[model samples]
Target: MKLKRTIIISIFFVLMLCGSVLASPSSNNAKRINSTYISATTEETNIRYINDKFEVAPDKQWTIKFNKEVNPLAINTENVQVLDSKGQAVNITLGLSSDGKHVSINPPASKYISGETYSLIIKKSLSNKLNETLPKEVRMKFTIMKDNSNDTGNNVNPVLYEARQGLDKIYNLVKTDKERALVSALRDGVNTKINNPSATIDVNPLKDQYGNLSSDEKSDFKNAILSNFSIGALFEIKSIFE
Candidate 1:
């Protein structure tokens, strides 16, 4: 089973390399349509150290077979850094793919300490000579696998609560982490105005595995931070699953 798991994971990485290119039309649309990948197996669950789909860790690998061929470019991993909760950075590098499709990220073995969640970020993106500027950076949220306890319904998860709260601050036009990060990433400089660009936003039902929504069920999640959340919320309450 272990060998089989390793083989499957090896195959998964190759496909990801091909798909990681950011310059492709599909990838560009991912910013709009969004993709959420769910990894349910024991092997995959162990890799990301998270139960949810779409988020992953550098140490883990998986296999995905696609019908079409994708031309993916090489990415420079020197600029990729893992940011801790306090926002300190640890460096990671790109692991060469054996197949044209597979890609891997190798962080220092020492950094995989027990019991802490860390966010992954790519400071610089890779672009090849073919005008195929792709192999884009990872997403914004922190990915941690170490020592943090799962949130209990009894005791609120302050970090998630704060993260949600930060979004609220942005929605209310107050200074918030979402506003800060979005403007900081998109802005030219301090006090400079940034324009809102139209893109397809992923409007998905943020339901649990059982597909149930509590009383406050009006809003749809767009996988967006403060600057983008407005696109996801619906004026009318949508699906109600039992």
Candidate 2:
């Protein structure tokens, strides 16, 4: 009976030791989490102020160039949130690159407050995916000076811009997805003219009166849209300057 009791006690001790060893690694290798990390990967990631240019025309729409090339996927952004210093939300979300190798933060004019330095916060972002916690923040400062164009406006009529940008690219063959989407979207305007007797469309943007874009061009435009920010899906409607 004593030998049997000793054997049981030995097993219990072994089980306890195994449990302790299992818990130790988890406590050691747990993810690191903290606030106060800066969002910028490089020290050069500074916000250049175009206030002087826009000051003349406050009412008109404008664009500010970050010149900061951000790789969204490399950041491993689990969820991205942009905020002002007061902690108000800026209307922009995180968008991933087609290859998932990069990331970009998209913000419209509505979210930006003139003369304010906004803070961008990112959480659950790591150098790799499946990471637990790697967060960061960056403060961007800029002020909206008044716009001074004769009709300086942020609201872009993309149809006009499309004509200007597409001027050089001849309608060879709608060989790309980028070309196709552009053709498809412009076709919406085209069909309008077809059904309505009075409706007239300037067919210049639609690739010489024919609405067609190849799969290859469509792929190019997909990248272009990210960098160009074709939110309205109209190239001409996008603002050139702030």
Q: Which has the greatest TM-score?
A: 1
Estimate, for each residue in 1-242, the C-alpha lDDT of model 1 and write its tens digit. Answer: 66754443333222111121000011101112123332222122112221212113335322322223223444444444556557776565554344544444555666444323355544324333343433333334333232224323223222222223223333324232332333222211100110111222121211121024222221221122323322112111011000
Cα lDDT for residue 123, model 2?
42
Q: Indicate the TM-score of model 2.
A: 0.27
Off by over 4 Å in 2: 1-78, 109-111, 124-127, 130-242
As a TM-score, model 1 comes out at 0.32
lDDT of 2 by residue, 114-209 (tens): 323344444434333443333333333222321224324333333433322232131222344344334333433422322232444443544431
Q: How far off is residue 226 in model 1, in Å?
A: 23
Error of 1 at 30 (Å): 29
Q: On a 0 to 100 scale, what is the lDDT of residue 104 in model 2?
A: 59
Q: What root-mean-square deviation over C-alphas does model 1 reach?
A: 20.0
